[model samples]
Structure formats: structure tokens, C-alpha cells
Target: MKIQKSFAQSVGTLYLVPTPIGNLEDMTFRAVKTLQTVDLIASEDTRNTQKLLNHFEVKVPQKSLHEHNYNERIPELLDFLRDGKSIAQVSDAGMPSISDPGHELVVACIEADIPVVALPGATAGMTALIASGLLPQPFYFYGFLQRKKSSQKKELEDLRNQTATLIFYESPHRVKETLKNVAEVFGNREVVICRELTKLYEEYLRGTAEELIEYLSEHSLKGECCLLVSGATEIAEEEVFEGTLKEQVEALISEGQTSKEAIKSVAKRHNLKKQDVYKEYHEL
Candidate 1:
């Protein structure tokens, strides 16, 4: 086990600073202070972070460390730390490494026995999850889903059995499609859509996936989105019949149940609409 005494020694410490997700006032005093005092600030977007720094009157010099450059930048930053010069890492918003850059640098620091300090501050996922009116604890925070339709559907299918509340970060453009996939794979579970968190236009849209899909169809959405989905409730064996939905339907049909009866039973057991079940059963 590696124990880190962040401030005990004078070796350069790597501070993982969390920035405000949307509202500027959400910035923590400690975060501001760290930014003000650190020798160098590694930012995901120097221009974006410069605006925040200017707002808080922090004039620390910054270097870009986004996804493309992190691999080459890690060594240079590690050298700075080795020289006993403290460094601070910040993303465009929220915690540096939560679905953002900085994880690699943090791992590099730990591997090199460098002290790493993390400041607690605003996080979009948790911020939305708590206000989402869903079970906060026992929640799974899956930062961002795959952008491709097939990949996203496969990911959702893998998460189908999780009993914990699910959290996902999604862009506004894909929220509707993602919700539709959730409805198809997870079966119309209750979902809360949190957008523009901590900002003046902050809004939460709560309903079943199907309802949200219809709502999105009528209204346009902007800004980032956090999706909070209720966990899977217990399913009885009798309700499911046997294997996969298709397999179960086939088994019931072989047991003398009509094709229509098998489809209806599978739909009800899985909390899906009859039409959806029919389409899946027939691969339509």
C-alpha cells in the first residue's frame, strides 16, 4: 500500500484541482488558492481555463494537457515535480480526471512516489445524482457512453443487471437517442435528465425513458446532460420463463403456448411494450 502524506515533505506535490462545472461561484477557496500558488497549471484547455483564472484573479502560467498531448506532456510535468516545483492540473470543468484529462498524470505521479493532492469541488455527475431524487448511494457513475449506436447499446445491455442507480454524462445532441436505447434495453425505467447544472438555466426532466424521448422529440435541449436511471428491480423466475427474451418466448411456444401468448408473456415479464417485444421476437 502506498501512503501519501501530501504536505509532509518538500518534494513537488501534484495537486488535482476541481474546477466549477458551470457556475463560477462553485469554485472552492482551496481550489482557487491552489491555482494561485502552484508553480505551473496544466490545463485541458488553456484558453478556457484562462477565463476562469481571470475571473478568480488567478494569474498562474498554464500549459495545455488535453487528450492529444497528455502522453508527451506527462514526462515534462513529472520532471518539474522532480525539481521540487509544485504543479496543479485542471480540466475545462469539474474534477480533472473524472471523464477528463489528468488520470495519466496522477498515475505517473503515484508511480514515481510523488505526493498527489486532490481538492474536493464541483462534479457534474454527483451534483445531478443528488438532486435527481434517485437513490444517491449505491449508484454507478459511468462517465460517458460510447458515441456509436451499436456500441452504446452493447454497453447498456451489459449494465442491464446492475441494481445500483446509474449515472451517465451525455451530450445534448445524443441524449434523445441514448434515452431511446435505455428504454429499449432497460425497459421504460424511470430516468432523470439533468442539464446545465448550477447555471441559471439548470433544469431537471424526470420521467420514464419513453416519456423523455417524446418530450425531447418536441423540445430542443442545449448544454451538457446527466442521465440518472433507477436501478433494476427484482425479477421473478416465473415472470422471465427461461433464457433470453427470444429464448424464453420460444421455450413457452414449444410448451404449447401460442406465439402471441409467448410474446405477451415475455413483454410483461420484462416490463416492455407488446409491440417492442413482438419486434424483437421477430427481429423486425
Candidate 2:
């Protein structure tokens, strides 16, 4: 195991600065200070970040490090850090690397034994979670669902038995469809939609998925959305197995699941390792 001491570092540090999701006042003093102090600011969008820097009167040199260019940009950024030129990475809104670009760079820095410091600030998931009025602790942060209907439904099915609250970020155009998928997989559980957080027109809609879908049928939603779904009811696992592991896997495969999917389902249902289930199924 490796230990990281953020402040005590010989090389230039990488500060993950969090920006405001909506209200400009949400920008912390430390965040502003770090941006000003850093030698270079690696931003998800240079143009978008420039506006924020302009607002805060922070005039640090900016470079684009978004999803499209991160693979190529990480090396140069690491070189800067090696040269003792500090960097503060910022996304367009909220925290960098939450649902944005920065995680890869963080991983790269860690692999290279570089210090990565994260400054606490605004995040849409937690910001919506605290006010969601649902079970707060042990909640799952699942940012963004699969856009394809079948794949998205499959993803929801994988989390069908989770007892922790599920949080997801969805675009305005797709929130309704995602809610429908949640209802189909997790049933008509309580769901909350937080919209335009920290802004003047912020709004929250709380109800079961079906109820929310009925409401959305009439109104057109605007702005980014955070979807919070209540967890499944706590239930004891089945005390007995229906058949041998091999038989169970075969049953699922016969019913149309791929071998990999069947093996995964068997493993999760029996609380066994996937490799163990695969071996039993293959008699290896």
C-alpha cells in the first residue's frame, strides 16, 4: 500500500479544484486561491473555463485537457509537474473528475508518485443527495446511465437488488426515459429529481417513478437533472439453491443470456466469485 501526503511534496502538486455547479458564490475561497497560485490551470474546456477565470479575476495560463485530448495531454501535464510547475485541474462546473475529465490524470499522477490534492467544493450528486430527503448514508453515486434503452435497462437490472440509494446524473432530454427504466427494473419506488441546483430557478420533484413519468408527460424539463431513487427493500437471500451452479448457469443461458452474463448472474445470486461459477459451469 502507498501513502500520500498532499502538502509535503518535493514535486509540483496537482490540485483538483472544484467549481460552482450553478451559483457563482458557491466557488470557495481556497478554490480561487489555488487557481491563482498554480503555475498552470488544466481545464476541461479552455473557453468555458476562461469565463470562470474572468469572473474570479484569476489569470492563470489555461490548457485544454478534456476527454478528446486527455490521452495526449496527460504526458505533457506530468512533465510540468515533474519540472515543479504546479497545476490546478478544473472542470466547467462542480468538481473535476466527478462526471468530468480528470480521473485519468489523477491515476497517471498516482502511478508516477505525484501528489494529488483535492479541494472540497460543490458536487451535484452530494448537493442533491443531502436535500433528497432519502436515506443519505451508504448511497450509491452512479453518474450518468447508458443512453441506449436495452443497455440502460441491463445496467439498471445489474443494480436491482442494491439496498443503498442510487444517484444518477441525466440530461434533461433523457431524464424521463431513465426514470421509466428505473421503474421497470426497480419498481415504483420513490424517486427525486433535482434540477438547476444552486441557481435562481432550481427545482425539485419527488415521487415514485411512475408518478413522475405521468407528470413529465405534460411538462417539458429543462437544464441538467440529478435523479435519486430509493433503494430496494431489505430481503434475506434465498436459503437454498435451486440446483447445482452448473445447472443454474445452463438454465440462464438457455433462457437467452450469454455465457458471461449467465455466469455473472449465478455468481451474484449465490454470493460466489465469478471465476468459481465459471469453473463450475465449465467443469474446469
TM-score top scorer: 2
lDDT of candidate 2 over 1-284, digit per residue (tens): 78999888889999999999999999999999999999999999899999999999998999999999988999999999999889999999998889999999999999999999999999999999999999998899999999999999989988888899999999999998898889888889999999999999999999889999999999988999999999889643546668899999999999999999999999988778999999999999
The 0-to-1 C-alpha lDDT of every candidate, in the order given, reads 0.92, 0.93
Could you tally the backbone clashes for each prediction?
0, 0
What lDDT is reached at residue 270 by model 2? 79
Q: Which stretches of candidate 1 lie over 4 Å from their true place?
A: 235-284
In angstroms, how far off is 217's CA in candidate 2?
0.4
RMSD of each: 7.0, 5.1
Tens digit of per-residue lDDT, candidate 1, span 1-284: 98888899677999999999999999989999999999999999999999999999998899999899988899999999999999999999999889998899999999999999999999999999989998998999998999999999989988888889999999999999999999998998999999999999999999999999999999989999999999989542332255777888898899999999999988877779989888888989
Q: Residue 74 CA error for candidate 2 (Å)?
A: 0.8
What C-alpha root-mean-square deviation, in Å, does candidate 1 show against the real structure? 7.0
- How does candidate 1 score on lDDT? 0.92
lDDT of 1 at 191: 99
